[model samples]
Target: MQRSSYRYLVVDVFADRPGAGNPLGVVLDAADWDSMRMQAFAAWTNLSETVYFLPPTTLDASYRIRIFTPRQELPFAGHPSVGAAWVSLETGLVSDTDRLVQECAAGRLPVRVVGTGPQRMITLRAPRARPVGIEPPPQALRAVLASLPTAGLQAALWNNGPSWWLMELEDDAAVRGLAPDLAAIAALTQATAAVGLAVFGRTPAGADHDLAVRAFCPADNIPEDPVTGSVNACIAAALDAADALPGHDGRYIASQGRELGRDGRVALQVDADGEVWIGGHVQGIIDGRATW
Candidate 1:
């Protein structure tokens, strides 16, 4: 029996509150594992996604990371990238090095660690977002409205690298308390070939945040993602069209998880040049060994 040692970190991307943000499991030092083993390990953790860290085969990068969901492997995932980078930092994979690069199936992405505080912020460079072609049926709008918690809001669809259904609510409160029908959403999204749906609105009357959001993707097999970086990316593009982003700086704060009572938050920023950066703090959850 061959035994392999692995360290896993529980990280919350896009939220400061412990249980509020999107959860990810980082398995550090997973070397030479095939896709089948990786898939099994990811299903074991059962988080939104689990990132496996591998030593770089070449000197071109620092580490190799693979992201997997319980159902399948993902080419790219936002929270997993942030969580993996944080795990690398915590595990001493990268020292006082302010800059770190990780190789993934998507490609090599560079990360810039801002500060060393308890809630350390790290910004990741997203690959060039090439919008894919999707022609959703006219019923997409109606299905979206019917599945939403609020019926009074207007919904718009956008393709920011990934297909996204953007719902603009009447108020921050409306966006915050949304309860979506996952099965319905998944069916519609899959039928329309949309990646997922993003619900958003202005901050509540007494809220400190700028906007509230929630994402649903049953076709992707995700139900009520606590915090979604890809959805935020789509929001960035949508807001750019509305000229709603402050100073037109292309950077904004997106709030999520409140609907689920988790209350997670994500920082969304995009440059005029179309570069996107998403970040948040993370915490370690568990670590152990895997025998196969």
Candidate 2:
């Protein structure tokens, strides 16, 4: 079999500075590649997520993208969506449109870009998320949470595309000090069909961000994700549903991945109608081609 070369870009999503957020691989042209090839390449890259850009099947969409993790393909993912949009604009794939319509297994979604150059920001109207209900802590979940201080903590299940078990801790300290049982977490996620457990807490008063967040997904071959847009979106949706979020502000920032030495900042906004938008600044890191 003959292998083909493709243009690829590596980008950091939800970061104000380079190398401060979740890294994603974007294959700019993958029309000829099949699903197996995409998955193989994604696993080879060893990134949390990789995306392939192809021509849109629908006339309304500017382009279509497929998201893949190291293990399998995902219908949708937040950082991959944002990173794909940035790569599209940067590579002139959708130059004529300010708002990009993306087609994926999750359906068509819209992305808006603001500013330019290093200051450029991209926001995606997240897929509609709803609280599935609170999950009773099973034995596996209990094992994972045993080391963490859980007093006054609240947990719930939310679905945006991937199902997540969201936990709100008392403060940033609790969130940051977690040493989770990855084996237990993997067992729980696999048994429940959830992606993983996501924990967050309120930041110190007057801090630059409103919340501190961390995600654990050993089941997905990722021990921890640096910055996760989908999980943050679900957190917002869950908080808004319970009326627990800050009342005075519809827009806030979430700080994540600091424990891993990453400074990821995710921008979140809730519309008057209660729709959530997840966005942040994306930086292009590697401009190169891949042959496999």
Candidate 3:
């Protein structure tokens, strides 16, 4: 029996509170595994996404990571990046406690550790996101979005490694009340080479969050992503481009996953230069060694 050892951890990212967030699988000491092994393990775990830690090949990067969905590898992902960095810092894979740079296929990105202990927060600056494609939206979504207000934002594709079709509905109620057609969404995503579709709407005044968000990705087998960071960042970019972000300050809290029985909040910041950063609290789930 050949037992290849790797330290694995499952940490919930984007949690508003402990135990209420999207879970990410982190595999450490995975330098020995090739892409096939990594993909196989990702498929076996069946999480939205899984990540592997490897030695940094770049000069200033604290470490390198590879992201994989159950079906294929991705250049970058929001929750996985933040969750992996948390595990890295906690497991001493990284020397610095305050900040570290990550090297991935999307290039080097910065991660920051905020506060301390269980209440600590981790934030990552995503690869600069931008709206992509000027074509019309998929016909599959016409029935789904019929009569829904655009909320002053254009419906378009946003790209940040993965592409997502983002739209803003009338209000948070419209977002929370949404029931997506999985088959239609899957077909649309597959046809457009996109990961999924994300919809956001303004929450009522005085709410803890400024907006409500939802993501659907049946093409990747995720009927509804619990809390998604990448798509959140993309939506922020789109909102900023349209000048339709709530309060116009470029900093707001977004609530997601409530419809899925999970509560998670993502903090989005669009800097003066329009660079988008997403941050949230993480809760650790599983910590143990794995044999492959």
Candidate 4:
């Protein structure tokens, strides 16, 4: 017996450079790939996440896609969807003439491709976010502000369906260039009732994005996410709905990964229709095969 060879492409999402954006493995035309094999491959890839593509079952459908992290499968993912959709459009799996609709565990998602050349962009609509309420475990707050001076740090909880611990910082400096205790977060996540942690605050004048953020999910196998669209989407929604966005109303940009040096920027737009649009540029890192 022999193991079937699986062909995949690696992409760097939310990055203009090779080693910058979050890396993702996109398996082109992975109809033959099973869930078990995909899970194994995802863990082996060891990237934040890997996306597998499948042909639509119905003629009216566009494409069916699945997202997997190292330890678990996700209902939705930001970078992988954008990267995979870009690959799909460029590879002719999806036509440029028609907009692409990707079916995932989260539900059907639409990705619109735009522009030509380096500035070309892809915008993804995160699953409609509802106010998850607000209150967090006490220790989770301590874990996030562990590095801070505690002068202006505050913690709260938001529980819609996914429990998120929202932490507010004094300024941009407190938000960026700091590290969270991953093990503490893992422990707090178990000890608490929340699903993850979201740290959000204003950005300094120098950063590229309007807001800076970092997310941690102990159970999700991601301690500190390089950049998470959905998490940011949820945060943006919460802020916008609560009338917390600075001078502007209902629109913002989020910066992530500054501490890890990956530094990623995500464009966010909150519409009156109650939808959040996250747009970013993705680059193809290794277009060839990985022997391992």
Q: What is the TM-score of each candidate against the true structure?
A: 0.86, 0.95, 0.95, 0.85
Model 1: lowest-lDDT 10 consecutive positions:
151-160
Model 1 per-residue lDDT tens digits across residues 195-215: 678788777445556778888
Candidate 3, superposed: residue stretches over 4 Å from native: 1-3, 134-138, 141-144, 147-150
**Pairs that collide, model 3:** none
**lDDT string, candidate 2, 1-292, tens digits:** 4457778889999888898999999998788899999999999998999999988999999889999989888887899998888888878888845688889988999888888755778899888888765356577767766666654436666889888888777788889898878888899788778888898988777898899999988988999999999999898888787777753578889999999999999889888888888898889899988988
What are the candidates' C-alpha RMSDs?
3.0, 1.7, 1.8, 3.2
The alpha-carbon root-mean-square deviation between model 3 and the true structure, to one decimal in Å, is 1.8
Ranking by lDDT: 3, 2, 4, 1
Give the 10-residue window scoring lowest on summed lDDT in candidate 2: 147-156
Error of 1 at 96 (Å): 2.4
Q: How many backbone collisions does model 2 have? A: 0
- Judged by lDDT, which candidate is best? 3
lDDT of every model, 2 decimals: 0.71, 0.85, 0.86, 0.72
> By TM-score, is 2 or 4 better?
2
Task: Kindly report which residue stretches of model 1 are placed more than 4 angstroms away from their true locations once superposed.
Answer: 1-4, 136-141, 147-163, 192-195, 204-206, 246-248, 290-292
17-55, model 3: which lDDT tens digit per residue?
667899998898788889999999998998999999989
lDDT of 1 at 150: 52
| Runs in model 4 lying further than 4 Å from the true structure | 1-3, 58-60, 133-163, 191-195, 204-207, 218-220, 247-249, 290-292
